[model samples]
Target: MKLYTIDTGFFKLDGGAMFGVVPKSIWQRTNPADERNLCTWATRLLLIEDGKRLTLVDTGLGDKQDDKFFGHYFRHGDATLDNSLAQHGFHRDDITDVILTHLHFDHCGGAVIREGERLLPAFKNARFWSNEKHWNWALHPNPREKASFLKENILPIEESGQLAFLKEGDLFSPNVAMRYAYGHTESMMLPQISYKGKTILYMADLLPSVGHIPLPYVMSYDVRPLTTMEERQSYWQEIVDKEYILFLEHDPVHACCTLKQTDKGIRVAETFALENI
Candidate 1:
Protein backbone atom coordinates (compact mmCIF):
# COMPACT_ATOMS: atom_id res chain seq x y z
CA MET A 1 0.00 0.00 0.00
CA LYS A 2 1.13 3.54 -0.81
CA LEU A 3 0.01 6.86 0.68
CA TYR A 4 0.08 10.35 -0.81
CA THR A 5 -0.64 13.72 0.80
CA ILE A 6 -3.02 15.52 -1.53
CA ASP A 7 -2.92 19.18 -0.64
CA THR A 8 -5.94 20.84 -2.18
CA GLY A 9 -5.06 24.30 -0.85
CA PHE A 10 -5.23 26.64 2.10
CA PHE A 11 -8.06 28.77 3.44
CA LYS A 12 -8.76 31.14 6.30
CA LEU A 13 -11.07 30.46 9.23
CA ASP A 14 -11.85 32.51 12.29
CA GLY A 15 -9.25 31.55 14.87
CA GLY A 16 -11.63 32.09 17.74
CA ALA A 17 -14.11 29.64 16.29
CA MET A 18 -11.44 27.09 15.48
CA PHE A 19 -10.24 27.05 19.06
CA GLY A 20 -13.34 27.12 21.19
CA VAL A 21 -13.05 28.75 24.62
CA VAL A 22 -9.28 28.99 24.19
CA PRO A 23 -8.04 32.54 24.51
CA LYS A 24 -6.32 34.22 21.55
CA SER A 25 -3.17 34.56 23.63
CA ILE A 26 -3.00 30.79 23.82
CA TRP A 27 -4.09 29.57 20.36
CA GLN A 28 -2.47 32.47 18.49
CA ARG A 29 0.90 31.26 19.74
CA THR A 30 0.45 28.07 17.73
CA ASN A 31 -1.80 29.23 14.85
CA PRO A 32 -1.11 32.91 14.41
CA ALA A 33 -3.97 34.87 12.92
CA ASP A 34 -3.97 37.49 10.23
CA GLU A 35 -5.09 41.09 10.66
CA ARG A 36 -8.66 39.89 10.19
CA ASN A 37 -8.29 37.37 13.03
CA LEU A 38 -8.58 34.53 10.57
CA CYS A 39 -6.07 31.72 10.81
CA THR A 40 -4.77 29.99 7.69
CA TRP A 41 -5.57 26.27 7.49
CA ALA A 42 -4.81 23.58 4.92
CA THR A 43 -7.53 21.51 3.35
CA ARG A 44 -5.14 18.60 3.06
CA LEU A 45 -6.55 15.29 1.87
CA LEU A 46 -5.07 11.81 1.94
CA LEU A 47 -4.81 9.33 -0.90
CA ILE A 48 -4.39 5.60 -0.41
CA GLU A 49 -3.17 3.41 -3.22
CA ASP A 50 -3.90 -0.23 -2.52
CA GLY A 51 -3.33 -2.20 -5.68
CA LYS A 52 -6.19 -1.25 -8.04
CA ARG A 53 -8.23 0.57 -5.40
CA LEU A 54 -7.31 4.25 -5.17
CA THR A 55 -9.09 5.85 -2.20
CA LEU A 56 -9.19 9.57 -1.48
CA VAL A 57 -9.88 10.28 2.18
CA ASP A 58 -11.47 13.70 1.85
CA THR A 59 -11.94 16.47 -0.70
CA GLY A 60 -11.02 20.07 -0.02
CA LEU A 61 -13.33 23.09 -0.06
CA GLY A 62 -14.35 23.02 -3.70
CA ASP A 63 -14.07 25.85 -6.25
CA LYS A 64 -17.73 25.71 -7.12
CA GLN A 65 -18.95 28.22 -4.53
CA ASP A 66 -19.71 31.72 -5.80
CA ASP A 67 -17.33 34.63 -5.22
CA LYS A 68 -19.63 36.13 -2.59
CA PHE A 69 -19.64 32.86 -0.72
CA PHE A 70 -15.87 32.36 -1.06
CA GLY A 71 -14.96 35.90 -0.06
CA HIS A 72 -15.82 35.02 3.53
CA TYR A 73 -13.22 32.25 3.72
CA PHE A 74 -10.17 33.54 1.79
CA ARG A 75 -9.26 30.37 -0.10
CA HIS A 76 -5.82 30.96 -1.51
CA GLY A 77 -3.05 28.73 -2.82
CA ASP A 78 -1.46 27.32 -6.00
CA ALA A 79 -2.16 23.68 -5.20
CA THR A 80 -5.42 22.21 -6.49
CA LEU A 81 -7.09 18.82 -6.23
CA ASP A 82 -6.36 18.03 -9.89
CA ASN A 83 -2.71 19.07 -9.73
CA SER A 84 -2.15 17.28 -6.44
CA LEU A 85 -3.62 14.05 -7.78
CA ALA A 86 -1.73 14.41 -11.06
CA GLN A 87 1.50 14.88 -9.15
CA HIS A 88 1.00 11.33 -7.91
CA GLY A 89 0.43 10.16 -11.53
CA PHE A 90 -3.30 9.69 -11.08
CA HIS A 91 -6.57 11.37 -12.09
CA ARG A 92 -10.06 11.74 -10.71
CA ASP A 93 -11.31 8.95 -12.94
CA ASP A 94 -8.87 6.53 -11.36
CA ILE A 95 -10.21 7.02 -7.83
CA THR A 96 -12.20 4.01 -6.65
CA ASP A 97 -13.37 5.31 -3.28
CA VAL A 98 -13.91 8.68 -1.58
CA ILE A 99 -14.03 8.20 2.21
CA LEU A 100 -15.56 11.30 3.69
CA THR A 101 -14.90 11.89 7.38
CA HIS A 102 -17.94 14.14 7.50
CA LEU A 103 -20.15 16.06 5.14
CA HIS A 104 -18.91 19.54 6.01
CA PHE A 105 -18.31 21.76 2.99
CA ASP A 106 -14.56 21.86 3.54
CA HIS A 107 -14.29 18.07 3.78
CA CYS A 108 -16.73 16.88 1.11
CA GLY A 109 -17.39 19.87 -1.15
CA GLY A 110 -14.93 18.72 -3.80
CA ALA A 111 -16.68 15.39 -4.08
CA VAL A 112 -19.10 17.05 -6.50
CA ILE A 113 -18.63 19.68 -9.15
CA ARG A 114 -20.91 21.97 -11.05
CA GLU A 115 -21.08 21.27 -14.78
CA GLY A 116 -23.30 23.82 -16.50
CA GLU A 117 -26.56 23.69 -14.50
CA ARG A 118 -26.08 20.17 -13.22
CA LEU A 119 -24.04 19.14 -10.19
CA LEU A 120 -22.14 15.88 -10.71
CA PRO A 121 -19.86 13.63 -8.78
CA ALA A 122 -16.26 14.73 -9.17
CA PHE A 123 -14.95 11.18 -9.35
CA LYS A 124 -16.95 9.52 -12.08
CA ASN A 125 -16.04 5.96 -11.07
CA ALA A 126 -15.61 6.27 -7.31
CA ARG A 127 -17.96 5.04 -4.63
CA PHE A 128 -18.51 7.84 -2.14
CA TRP A 129 -18.29 6.37 1.40
CA SER A 130 -20.14 8.02 4.29
CA ASN A 131 -21.76 6.55 7.37
CA GLU A 132 -25.55 6.27 7.59
CA LYS A 133 -25.85 8.60 10.60
CA HIS A 134 -23.75 11.31 9.03
CA TRP A 135 -25.58 10.95 5.74
CA ASN A 136 -28.88 11.57 7.51
CA TRP A 137 -27.49 14.42 9.60
CA ALA A 138 -26.16 16.20 6.51
CA LEU A 139 -29.30 15.65 4.50
CA HIS A 140 -31.50 17.14 7.19
CA PRO A 141 -29.07 19.51 8.77
CA ASN A 142 -29.91 21.58 11.83
CA PRO A 143 -29.98 25.36 11.66
CA ARG A 144 -26.53 25.76 13.19
CA GLU A 145 -24.79 23.44 10.69
CA LYS A 146 -27.01 24.06 7.69
CA ALA A 147 -24.59 26.52 6.20
CA SER A 148 -21.67 24.06 6.36
CA PHE A 149 -23.62 21.23 4.79
CA LEU A 150 -24.35 22.47 1.32
CA LYS A 151 -26.92 20.46 -0.57
CA GLU A 152 -25.14 21.00 -3.88
CA ASN A 153 -21.92 19.41 -2.64
CA ILE A 154 -23.91 16.51 -1.22
CA LEU A 155 -27.04 14.69 -2.58
CA PRO A 156 -25.30 14.38 -5.95
CA ILE A 157 -23.47 11.19 -4.95
CA GLU A 158 -26.72 9.59 -3.87
CA GLU A 159 -28.35 10.89 -7.02
CA SER A 160 -25.49 9.48 -9.07
CA GLY A 161 -25.99 6.05 -7.51
CA GLN A 162 -22.44 5.91 -6.14
CA LEU A 163 -23.08 6.45 -2.44
CA ALA A 164 -22.29 3.61 -0.03
CA PHE A 165 -22.48 3.41 3.76
CA LEU A 166 -19.97 1.44 5.79
CA LYS A 167 -21.74 -0.90 8.13
CA GLU A 168 -21.17 -0.18 11.83
CA GLY A 169 -18.04 -1.99 13.07
CA ASP A 170 -17.03 -2.77 9.47
CA LEU A 171 -13.36 -2.77 8.60
CA PHE A 172 -12.79 0.00 6.04
CA SER A 173 -10.12 -1.92 4.14
CA PRO A 174 -7.66 -4.75 4.62
CA ASN A 175 -5.44 -2.61 6.84
CA VAL A 176 -7.86 0.13 7.88
CA ALA A 177 -10.73 0.16 10.38
CA MET A 178 -13.38 2.77 11.16
CA ARG A 179 -13.77 4.52 14.49
CA TYR A 180 -16.93 6.58 14.95
CA ALA A 181 -16.72 9.98 16.61
CA TYR A 182 -19.64 12.31 17.39
CA GLY A 183 -18.16 15.36 19.05
CA HIS A 184 -17.43 17.24 15.84
CA THR A 185 -20.39 15.84 13.97
CA GLU A 186 -22.67 12.87 14.13
CA SER A 187 -20.86 9.64 13.43
CA MET A 188 -17.70 11.09 11.93
CA MET A 189 -15.57 8.19 10.71
CA LEU A 190 -11.90 8.36 11.57
CA PRO A 191 -9.89 5.80 9.64
CA GLN A 192 -7.46 3.82 11.79
CA ILE A 193 -5.01 2.44 9.27
CA SER A 194 -2.53 -0.28 10.25
CA TYR A 195 0.53 -0.19 8.02
CA LYS A 196 3.98 -1.69 8.61
CA GLY A 197 2.92 -2.76 12.11
CA LYS A 198 1.99 0.80 13.08
CA THR A 199 -1.34 2.59 13.33
CA ILE A 200 -1.93 5.92 11.59
CA LEU A 201 -5.11 7.55 12.85
CA TYR A 202 -6.60 10.05 10.42
CA MET A 203 -7.37 12.86 12.85
CA ALA A 204 -10.21 14.42 10.93
CA ASP A 205 -11.98 17.02 13.07
CA LEU A 206 -11.49 14.97 16.19
CA LEU A 207 -8.05 16.56 16.39
CA PRO A 208 -7.67 19.15 13.62
CA SER A 209 -4.11 20.07 14.51
CA VAL A 210 -1.36 19.46 17.00
CA GLY A 211 -2.45 22.64 18.75
CA HIS A 212 -5.71 20.87 19.51
CA ILE A 213 -3.93 18.15 21.47
CA PRO A 214 -5.20 19.57 24.78
CA LEU A 215 -8.58 18.19 25.74
CA PRO A 216 -10.06 21.65 26.22
CA TYR A 217 -9.04 22.95 22.79
CA VAL A 218 -12.20 21.78 21.13
CA MET A 219 -13.53 23.64 18.12
CA SER A 220 -16.51 25.95 18.60
CA TYR A 221 -18.09 24.39 15.55
CA ASP A 222 -18.53 21.15 17.39
CA VAL A 223 -22.13 20.60 18.36
CA ARG A 224 -21.26 18.89 21.62
CA PRO A 225 -18.18 20.49 23.14
CA LEU A 226 -18.30 18.42 26.34
CA THR A 227 -18.58 15.26 24.28
CA THR A 228 -15.52 16.38 22.35
CA MET A 229 -13.57 16.79 25.57
CA GLU A 230 -14.45 13.27 26.65
CA GLU A 231 -13.72 11.88 23.18
CA ARG A 232 -10.30 13.54 22.98
CA GLN A 233 -9.28 12.30 26.42
CA SER A 234 -10.10 8.69 25.54
CA TYR A 235 -8.62 8.90 22.04
CA TRP A 236 -5.43 10.57 23.23
CA GLN A 237 -4.92 7.87 25.86
CA GLU A 238 -5.19 5.22 23.18
CA ILE A 239 -2.87 7.16 20.86
CA VAL A 240 -0.20 7.32 23.57
CA ASP A 241 -0.63 3.68 24.55
CA LYS A 242 -0.37 2.47 20.93
CA GLU A 243 2.10 5.14 19.78
CA TYR A 244 -0.14 6.00 16.83
CA ILE A 245 0.94 8.51 14.24
CA LEU A 246 -1.74 11.19 13.92
CA PHE A 247 -2.33 12.37 10.34
CA LEU A 248 -3.64 15.92 10.67
CA GLU A 249 -6.10 17.25 8.10
CA HIS A 250 -6.32 21.01 8.69
CA ASP A 251 -2.94 21.78 10.24
CA PRO A 252 -1.11 24.13 7.88
CA VAL A 253 2.36 23.59 9.29
CA HIS A 254 2.58 19.96 10.40
CA ALA A 255 1.39 16.90 8.52
CA CYS A 256 1.84 14.21 11.17
CA CYS A 257 2.89 13.93 14.81
CA THR A 258 3.46 11.50 17.66
CA LEU A 259 2.11 12.06 21.15
CA LYS A 260 3.73 11.38 24.50
CA GLN A 261 2.28 11.41 28.00
CA THR A 262 3.28 14.47 29.92
CA ASP A 263 2.55 15.59 33.48
CA LYS A 264 -0.27 17.80 32.24
CA GLY A 265 -1.64 15.36 29.66
CA ILE A 266 -0.91 13.99 26.20
CA ARG A 267 1.09 16.44 24.11
CA VAL A 268 2.86 16.30 20.78
CA ALA A 269 6.22 14.58 21.23
CA GLU A 270 7.42 15.42 17.72
CA THR A 271 6.05 16.96 14.56
CA PHE A 272 7.30 16.02 11.08
CA ALA A 273 6.24 15.59 7.53
CA LEU A 274 4.56 12.35 6.50
CA GLU A 275 7.55 11.38 4.35
CA ASN A 276 9.67 11.21 7.50
CA ILE A 277 7.47 8.37 8.73
Candidate 2:
Protein backbone atom coordinates (compact mmCIF):
# COMPACT_ATOMS: atom_id res chain seq x y z
CA MET A 1 0.00 0.00 0.00
CA LYS A 2 1.11 3.58 -0.68
CA LEU A 3 -0.09 7.04 0.43
CA TYR A 4 0.28 10.48 -1.09
CA THR A 5 -0.64 14.00 -0.07
CA ILE A 6 -2.75 15.58 -2.81
CA ASP A 7 -2.63 19.33 -2.29
CA THR A 8 -5.68 20.72 -4.11
CA GLY A 9 -4.94 24.37 -3.43
CA PHE A 10 -5.10 27.16 -0.86
CA PHE A 11 -7.71 29.72 0.21
CA LYS A 12 -8.20 32.39 2.85
CA LEU A 13 -10.60 32.34 5.80
CA ASP A 14 -11.33 34.80 8.59
CA GLY A 15 -8.75 34.43 11.35
CA GLY A 16 -11.37 34.76 14.05
CA ALA A 17 -13.66 32.18 12.50
CA MET A 18 -10.85 29.67 12.12
CA PHE A 19 -9.58 30.13 15.68
CA GLY A 20 -12.92 30.55 17.45
CA VAL A 21 -12.57 32.22 20.88
CA VAL A 22 -8.80 32.12 20.58
CA PRO A 23 -7.58 35.66 20.12
CA LYS A 24 -5.66 36.84 17.05
CA SER A 25 -2.60 37.76 19.12
CA ILE A 26 -2.25 34.09 20.10
CA TRP A 27 -3.27 32.27 16.90
CA GLN A 28 -1.52 34.73 14.59
CA ARG A 29 1.80 33.50 15.91
CA THR A 30 1.32 30.09 14.21
CA ASN A 31 -1.27 31.01 11.55
CA PRO A 32 -0.44 34.62 10.84
CA ALA A 33 -3.18 36.64 9.13
CA ASP A 34 -2.96 39.30 6.49
CA GLU A 35 -4.04 42.92 6.87
CA ARG A 36 -7.53 41.82 5.79
CA ASN A 37 -7.73 39.51 8.84
CA LEU A 38 -7.89 36.43 6.61
CA CYS A 39 -5.34 33.67 6.97
CA THR A 40 -4.16 31.30 4.23
CA TRP A 41 -5.33 27.66 4.43
CA ALA A 42 -4.51 24.65 2.33
CA THR A 43 -7.13 22.38 0.79
CA ARG A 44 -5.07 19.24 1.38
CA LEU A 45 -6.42 15.76 0.59
CA LEU A 46 -5.07 12.24 1.02
CA LEU A 47 -4.94 9.43 -1.54
CA ILE A 48 -4.58 5.73 -0.77
CA GLU A 49 -3.43 3.23 -3.35
CA ASP A 50 -3.72 -0.41 -2.48
CA GLY A 51 -3.44 -2.21 -5.75
CA LYS A 52 -6.16 -1.22 -8.28
CA ARG A 53 -8.50 0.32 -5.72
CA LEU A 54 -7.57 3.99 -5.27
CA THR A 55 -9.39 5.90 -2.54
CA LEU A 56 -9.45 9.69 -2.14
CA VAL A 57 -10.05 10.91 1.40
CA ASP A 58 -11.47 14.43 0.86
CA THR A 59 -11.72 16.83 -2.07
CA GLY A 60 -11.05 20.55 -1.91
CA LEU A 61 -13.37 23.31 -3.18
CA GLY A 62 -14.13 22.96 -6.85
CA ASP A 63 -14.23 25.79 -9.44
CA LYS A 64 -17.91 25.50 -10.33
CA GLN A 65 -19.01 28.47 -8.25
CA ASP A 66 -19.31 31.82 -10.02
CA ASP A 67 -16.95 34.70 -9.38
CA LYS A 68 -19.35 36.40 -6.98
CA PHE A 69 -19.66 33.29 -4.84
CA PHE A 70 -15.92 32.50 -4.88
CA GLY A 71 -14.87 36.08 -4.18
CA HIS A 72 -16.05 35.60 -0.61
CA TYR A 73 -13.48 32.90 0.25
CA PHE A 74 -10.66 34.11 -2.03
CA ARG A 75 -9.57 30.69 -3.43
CA HIS A 76 -6.15 31.11 -4.96
CA GLY A 77 -3.53 28.45 -5.65
CA ASP A 78 -1.46 26.90 -8.42
CA ALA A 79 -2.55 23.29 -7.78
CA THR A 80 -6.00 21.92 -8.65
CA LEU A 81 -7.65 18.57 -7.99
CA ASP A 82 -6.90 17.32 -11.47
CA ASN A 83 -3.37 18.65 -11.50
CA SER A 84 -2.62 17.23 -8.09
CA LEU A 85 -3.96 13.81 -9.04
CA ALA A 86 -1.89 13.85 -12.22
CA GLN A 87 1.20 14.85 -10.30
CA HIS A 88 1.14 11.42 -8.65
CA GLY A 89 0.25 9.64 -11.93
CA PHE A 90 -3.49 9.34 -11.44
CA HIS A 91 -6.76 10.80 -12.72
CA ARG A 92 -10.34 11.42 -11.56
CA ASP A 93 -11.57 8.27 -13.28
CA ASP A 94 -8.93 6.21 -11.50
CA ILE A 95 -10.44 6.87 -8.10
CA THR A 96 -12.59 3.89 -7.04
CA ASP A 97 -13.77 5.26 -3.69
CA VAL A 98 -14.24 8.80 -2.37
CA ILE A 99 -14.43 9.20 1.41
CA LEU A 100 -16.10 12.53 2.20
CA THR A 101 -15.63 13.31 5.91
CA HIS A 102 -18.57 15.72 5.70
CA LEU A 103 -20.56 17.51 3.02
CA HIS A 104 -19.13 20.91 3.86
CA PHE A 105 -18.40 22.89 0.69
CA ASP A 106 -14.67 23.05 1.27
CA HIS A 107 -14.40 19.32 1.94
CA CYS A 108 -16.69 17.83 -0.69
CA GLY A 109 -17.29 20.58 -3.25
CA GLY A 110 -14.79 19.11 -5.67
CA ALA A 111 -16.63 15.77 -5.76
CA VAL A 112 -19.18 17.23 -8.18
CA ILE A 113 -18.73 19.40 -11.23
CA ARG A 114 -20.78 21.77 -13.38
CA GLU A 115 -21.73 20.33 -16.72
CA GLY A 116 -23.24 22.64 -19.33
CA GLU A 117 -26.73 22.56 -17.84
CA ARG A 118 -26.33 19.94 -15.16
CA LEU A 119 -24.41 19.22 -11.98
CA LEU A 120 -22.68 15.86 -12.07
CA PRO A 121 -20.27 13.68 -10.11
CA ALA A 122 -16.71 14.68 -10.87
CA PHE A 123 -15.49 11.11 -10.39
CA LYS A 124 -17.94 9.56 -12.80
CA ASN A 125 -17.13 5.92 -11.94
CA ALA A 126 -16.39 6.12 -8.22
CA ARG A 127 -18.67 5.48 -5.28
CA PHE A 128 -18.97 8.57 -3.09
CA TRP A 129 -18.85 7.73 0.64
CA SER A 130 -20.78 9.63 3.33
CA ASN A 131 -22.63 8.67 6.49
CA GLU A 132 -26.46 8.65 6.61
CA LYS A 133 -26.59 11.09 9.51
CA HIS A 134 -24.27 13.61 7.85
CA TRP A 135 -26.04 13.23 4.49
CA ASN A 136 -29.41 14.07 6.03
CA TRP A 137 -27.88 16.86 8.08
CA ALA A 138 -26.45 18.46 4.95
CA LEU A 139 -29.73 18.02 3.09
CA HIS A 140 -31.60 19.96 5.75
CA PRO A 141 -28.92 22.06 7.37
CA ASN A 142 -29.74 24.48 10.15
CA PRO A 143 -29.65 28.20 9.36
CA ARG A 144 -26.27 28.43 11.02
CA GLU A 145 -24.59 25.92 8.64
CA LYS A 146 -26.77 26.23 5.55
CA ALA A 147 -24.12 28.25 3.77
CA SER A 148 -21.58 25.48 4.19
CA PHE A 149 -23.84 22.81 2.70
CA LEU A 150 -24.25 23.98 -0.86
CA LYS A 151 -26.67 21.92 -2.97
CA GLU A 152 -24.72 22.16 -6.22
CA ASN A 153 -21.71 20.56 -4.55
CA ILE A 154 -23.78 17.77 -3.00
CA LEU A 155 -27.11 16.20 -4.22
CA PRO A 156 -25.50 15.11 -7.47
CA ILE A 157 -23.62 12.24 -5.88
CA GLU A 158 -26.93 10.58 -5.04
CA GLU A 159 -28.42 11.77 -8.31
CA SER A 160 -25.59 9.95 -10.08
CA GLY A 161 -26.64 6.68 -8.37
CA GLN A 162 -23.16 6.34 -6.92
CA LEU A 163 -23.60 7.57 -3.35
CA ALA A 164 -22.98 4.95 -0.64
CA PHE A 165 -23.46 5.31 3.10
CA LEU A 166 -20.88 3.75 5.37
CA LYS A 167 -22.00 0.63 7.23
CA GLU A 168 -20.95 -0.74 10.61
CA GLY A 169 -17.20 -1.37 10.72
CA ASP A 170 -16.63 0.51 7.48
CA LEU A 171 -13.25 -0.27 5.93
CA PHE A 172 -11.85 1.36 2.81
CA SER A 173 -8.96 -1.10 2.81
CA PRO A 174 -7.53 -3.81 5.03
CA ASN A 175 -5.25 -1.33 6.78
CA VAL A 176 -7.43 1.81 6.69
CA ALA A 177 -10.13 2.22 9.36
CA MET A 178 -13.00 4.72 9.54
CA ARG A 179 -13.38 6.61 12.82
CA TYR A 180 -16.25 8.94 13.74
CA ALA A 181 -16.19 12.42 15.29
CA TYR A 182 -19.36 14.45 16.02
CA GLY A 183 -18.09 17.73 17.45
CA HIS A 184 -17.30 19.22 14.09
CA THR A 185 -20.36 17.88 12.24
CA GLU A 186 -22.79 15.00 12.48
CA SER A 187 -21.18 11.62 11.80
CA MET A 188 -17.99 13.05 10.34
CA MET A 189 -15.67 10.14 9.47
CA LEU A 190 -11.91 10.49 9.94
CA PRO A 191 -9.82 7.91 8.12
CA GLN A 192 -7.20 6.23 10.26
CA ILE A 193 -4.77 4.37 8.08
CA SER A 194 -1.94 2.04 9.07
CA TYR A 195 1.00 3.04 6.93
CA LYS A 196 4.73 2.52 7.21
CA GLY A 197 4.32 0.79 10.57
CA LYS A 198 2.53 3.82 12.00
CA THR A 199 -1.10 4.93 12.42
CA ILE A 200 -1.89 8.21 10.62
CA LEU A 201 -5.11 10.07 11.31
CA TYR A 202 -6.55 12.32 8.58
CA MET A 203 -7.84 15.24 10.65
CA ALA A 204 -10.81 16.69 8.78
CA ASP A 205 -11.63 19.86 10.68
CA LEU A 206 -11.59 18.04 14.01
CA LEU A 207 -8.02 19.40 14.17
CA PRO A 208 -7.43 21.77 11.29
CA SER A 209 -3.91 22.96 11.97
CA VAL A 210 -0.97 22.66 14.34
CA GLY A 211 -2.21 25.73 16.23
CA HIS A 212 -5.41 23.86 17.15
CA ILE A 213 -3.49 21.36 19.31
CA PRO A 214 -4.54 23.34 22.38
CA LEU A 215 -7.88 22.07 23.71
CA PRO A 216 -9.61 25.48 23.56
CA TYR A 217 -8.58 26.30 20.01
CA VAL A 218 -11.85 25.08 18.52
CA MET A 219 -13.33 26.61 15.39
CA SER A 220 -16.38 28.88 15.54
CA TYR A 221 -17.96 26.85 12.74
CA ASP A 222 -18.29 23.79 14.96
CA VAL A 223 -21.94 23.28 15.90
CA ARG A 224 -21.15 22.24 19.47
CA PRO A 225 -18.20 24.12 20.93
CA LEU A 226 -18.28 22.38 24.30
CA THR A 227 -18.54 18.99 22.65
CA THR A 228 -15.55 19.87 20.52
CA MET A 229 -13.42 20.58 23.58
CA GLU A 230 -14.33 17.28 25.20
CA GLU A 231 -13.67 15.38 21.99
CA ARG A 232 -10.32 17.06 21.53
CA GLN A 233 -9.25 16.35 25.09
CA SER A 234 -9.98 12.66 24.77
CA TYR A 235 -8.34 12.25 21.37
CA TRP A 236 -5.45 14.53 22.21
CA GLN A 237 -4.40 12.16 24.98
CA GLU A 238 -4.96 9.04 22.86
CA ILE A 239 -2.99 10.56 19.97
CA VAL A 240 -0.03 11.21 22.21
CA ASP A 241 -0.26 7.90 24.05
CA LYS A 242 -0.44 5.98 20.78
CA GLU A 243 2.04 8.31 19.10
CA TYR A 244 -0.19 8.78 16.07
CA ILE A 245 1.02 10.89 13.20
CA LEU A 246 -1.65 13.51 12.45
CA PHE A 247 -2.12 14.43 8.80
CA LEU A 248 -3.45 17.97 8.87
CA GLU A 249 -5.80 19.12 6.08
CA HIS A 250 -5.93 22.90 6.41
CA ASP A 251 -2.50 23.60 7.93
CA PRO A 252 -0.86 25.98 5.46
CA VAL A 253 2.67 25.38 6.72
CA HIS A 254 2.85 21.82 7.97
CA ALA A 255 1.76 18.57 6.36
CA CYS A 256 1.92 16.29 9.42
CA CYS A 257 2.87 16.51 13.10
CA THR A 258 3.57 14.33 16.11
CA LEU A 259 2.51 15.31 19.63
CA LYS A 260 4.43 15.51 22.91
CA GLN A 261 3.09 15.81 26.44
CA THR A 262 5.03 18.61 28.08
CA ASP A 263 4.71 20.60 31.27
CA LYS A 264 3.09 23.42 29.31
CA GLY A 265 0.65 20.86 27.82
CA ILE A 266 0.41 18.81 24.62
CA ARG A 267 2.36 20.45 21.82
CA VAL A 268 3.84 19.55 18.46
CA ALA A 269 6.74 17.15 18.96
CA GLU A 270 7.78 17.07 15.32
CA THR A 271 6.63 18.37 11.93
CA PHE A 272 7.65 17.02 8.53
CA ALA A 273 6.40 15.85 5.16
CA LEU A 274 4.52 12.56 4.90
CA GLU A 275 7.26 11.15 2.66
CA ASN A 276 9.80 11.65 5.38
CA ILE A 277 8.13 8.97 7.45
Strongest candidate by lDDT: 1
| lDDT (10s digit) by residue, model 1, range 77-109 | 899999999998999999999999999999998
Superposed Cα deviation of residue 175, candidate 2 (Å): 1.1
lDDT agreement with native, every candidate: 0.93, 0.92
Kindly list the per-residue Cα lDDT of model 2 for residues 155-193, writing each as its tens digit.
889988999998648786789889888888888899999
Model 2 Cα shift for residue 84 (angstroms) = 1.2
Sequence-dependent TM-score of model 1: 0.99
